[model samples]
Target: MFKKLVVGTLATGIVLTGGIGSASASTEGVENTKQVAPIAQKIKLETNYSSTNNQYGFTYTWDSNRQVYKTYDFYRHDGVFASYFESEGIKWYFKGKVRDLPGGGALGHYEGKK
Candidate 1:
């Protein structure tokens, strides 16, 4: 048992030291490393469309106004409209608590609620 423990410790030390040394050595050319261009931001939506609302398309209903003009709004990250809604002219929009995606998975019914 003692021999095994010692061997294990030695192996771990060797691995750790090798990793650290290699990492340090790799930094030797840091000054000559090419500057990487900023990666384009990508938005990944786990789910799109509202199941309960039976709505399609990217737009959503902002408000219901007695069968008049329904208000609509859109959700955008960095000015890109990811989601939107349509409703009466009342101009409805998602609240602060609304989830980024539709359906009740993230925020439950609260996401569909006004």
Candidate 2:
């Protein structure tokens, strides 16, 4: 068990160091590295978009009338991205962000803006 754990740790370190070291070479390469490396991403918003929402789009009533808008925003992080949202004249802000842990999995935050 100890041998297995050591081997796994060593392997993970090698891959992370290698990929992260070269992540800035190119955009395509960065994406590939993100897939290989154990990057974390945490999406704050709920993305349960139905077919109707996609087709007709969802509505947000900011004022008495009604309005709706949404968007995706990011600051070009290694493996992190954010989402934006807007409701008619009303504006929204980012919720939370996710950072890569030492273990595995991806956790990201959904950021929003007008």
Candidate 3:
């Protein structure tokens, strides 16, 4: 009976400790919040185009103060008006917001025409 009890306790401990679970089970819910933390920082604009895809772009630098978020703008040959938008995480433009992504696809400072 004592040996059986010991074996039972060992089995329970192993299960509880995830010794017999899949590799992913160990990190089931332990999220890396730090990794998701907003990377707020200044960015250097890099791109040149009149009205084409990949017109204007920027590379953000790590900043100790501030959570970097996406900033959108329209680019036009004439400096009249500009459209603006913002987002965090992947892809500044999402499926839900696809409609909001400007039709003609202007770059840098969106204006009236949508």
**Candidate 1 weakest ten by summed lDDT:** 103-112
lDDT of candidate model 3 versus the reference = 0.41
List TM-score per model, in order. 0.24, 0.18, 0.18
Candidate 3 residue lDDT tens string, 22-92: 43435557668347767899876544223333434533232223332223343334433323344233233
- Please name the candidate that would achieve the greatest TM-score relative to the true structure: 1
lDDT of 2 by residue, 73-106 (tens): 2223354433444444334554444455455433
**Highest lDDT: which candidate?**
2
Query: 7-40, model 1: which lDDT tens digit per residue?
Result: 9998898897876456554556567577777889
**Cand. 3 TM to true fold:** 0.18
List residue ranges in candidate 1 displaced over 4 A. 6-24, 29-34, 44-114
Clashes of each: 14, 13, 17
Question: lDDT of all the models against the reference?
Answer: 0.41, 0.43, 0.41
What is the lDDT, from 0 to 100, of the residue 96 in candidate 3? 22
Off by over 4 Å in 2: 1-47, 50-92, 101-107, 111-114
